[model samples]
Target: MPRSEYVASIRSRIGTDLLLLPGVTAVIRDEDRFLLARHQHSGLWSLIGGAVEPGEEPGEAVIREVFEETAANVRVRRIVGVYGGHPMMVTYPNGDQVGYVTTAYDCELLSPATPDLDELLEVGWFERDEIKTLPRRTWIDRVIDDVPRGSV
Candidate 1:
């Protein structure tokens, strides 16, 4: 997906300099397994989530992000965690650097769906052991418990 208009406006002014932004993510869990998306750009398996649009609540953002990214309908169960810094910082292929303060939700999948392909390569559920083997963002340990670090 392209940068949100809100973000584009910021980039127009700052021009790829570091920007701290609010983001949301969903840890869509079904018992021991979790729903994750494989990003087309990074080739990393990550939680289903995205930035909080202007005037949107974090909860609403997570729900919207889940559906947009994976075509999955989800309900926010509760906030799982809030994180920032190293792992949350992103430098896009275009060199637009963003540091995200991400609000993560414990979400329940109302219905599973396919990945958008534009944003993701695949979307599916994986067990704890399986996830550890997949390439993942650094924040995986902060999101899921008792897992060894993942590839990438």
Candidate 2:
């Protein structure tokens, strides 16, 4: 998608006025490796997560989204932190805009299975060093570093 189209898509989703919505992001790790997805939207690597639907909690959203995108059953352990995407803007392919407030969590994989790639282009567990090398969004590095070092 072109940059202008992406920006327009984001604008449509968010509208002209900014809106704050609840979102969930999961940091699933095993043996010092974290699960990351290659986002289909912009081709940038990021954690598996999505918007928290009405009447749904952030943790619930993370679990559901992780399963849907990666097919890995996960249990959210704790909320690492909440981050605002105010300074940032996300644009979609259809010219929609989205302003996001993401609740990041430290989670563990409950099922010993590989991820199914429907929403995601690719999925894998990567070490911290490896994560640093991937073409990831700005928020990803902070999310990975904040994982309570040794929590996995």
Displacement of the residue 145 alpha carbon in candidate 2, Å: 1.7
Q: Give the distance in Å from residue 121's predicted Cα in candidate 2 to where it truly belongs.
A: 0.6
How close is each model in CA RMSD to the real structure? 4.1, 4.9
Model 2 agreement with the true structure over 1-152: per-residue lDDT tens digits: 22334445655665655545567898888767888888777788888787777777778889988877767798888898888764345766654566678998888888853555445678878898798898987777877777766645
TM-score of each: 0.92, 0.81
**Candidate 1 lDDT score at position 48:** 80
What number of clashing residue pairs does each candidate have, in the order they appear? 0, 11
Q: What is the C-alpha lDDT of each candidate?
A: 0.84, 0.74
> Which regions in candidate 2 have their CA more than 4 angstroms from the true location?
1-19, 86-88, 113-116
Worst 10 residues of 2 by lDDT: 1-10
